[model samples]
Target: MNKKVMSIAAMVAGFGPSAYSLADSQHDEAIERGQAHYLLFCANCHGVDADGNGPLVELLKVTPTNLTTLRSSGSEATVAERVLQAVDGRHAVGESAERKMPVFSDNLEISTVIEIAAYLDSIQK
Candidate 1:
């Protein structure tokens, strides 16, 4: 290929991943923020390490889930969907009256929930 044509191709390829990287970096930032949120609210039950070994686990009748392995077991999209649903109360309401998990819909903003989902996505085993 001519030098000019090769240069053009290089530019095009560079531009593509640049756009994707920008968005990917933004998503990474969201995940970091979500981890912070999880620590503040969920860490009590999910554990600071996110291994479902939170200090409060002994007090609860039901066992907490291991947050780290969520992605390894399922698609990232499905994990995020489930997390968002539970945070928003859609999953909570569907559960029986003896729900152990608190519905964050009333307390957490949508952005916060999204951040948490992103964080969970990054930490998956």
Candidate 2:
């Protein structure tokens, strides 16, 4: 290869890790925001750790689902779909039948919902 071409390739290769690190940093920031939003809006029912044993769950007609298990629902598509429905208030996938989880469409922006979904996915084992 030409010397100039080889140098350009080396420079481009060196930039890869920095670009990936920046993207990772942004993902971390999104997760942090999602965690804050979950704490403020969902922790009361879902619990601070998302185990679904929050104090308020006892008073409710139904219990909330342990969100950490959402990945076991079979696939990422299913999880994403359920999250969208819950956020949209059309249905509650894993929660108890009588639960009255409020729709967040009006209270949160669409980007917030996406971030929450991403955060939830991150925590799923």
Tell me the number of clashing residue pairs for each predicted model: 0, 0
lDDT of each: 0.67, 0.66
lDDT of 2 at 1: 30
Off by over 4 Å in 1: 1-20, 74-77, 92-98
Positional deviation of residue 6's Cα in model 1 after best superposition, in angstroms? 42
- Measured by TM-score, how close is model 1 to the native structure? 0.71
Candidate 2 per-residue C-alpha lDDT over 4-108 given as tens digits, one digit per residue, 9 for 90 to 100: 334433433332335456577776777788788878878898898888887799788768878888869664444445565676666535444543677787888
lDDT of 2: 0.66
lDDT of 1 by residue, 53-89 (tens): 9999999987877878875764433456657655654
RMSD of each: 12.0, 12.1
Best model number under TM-score? 2
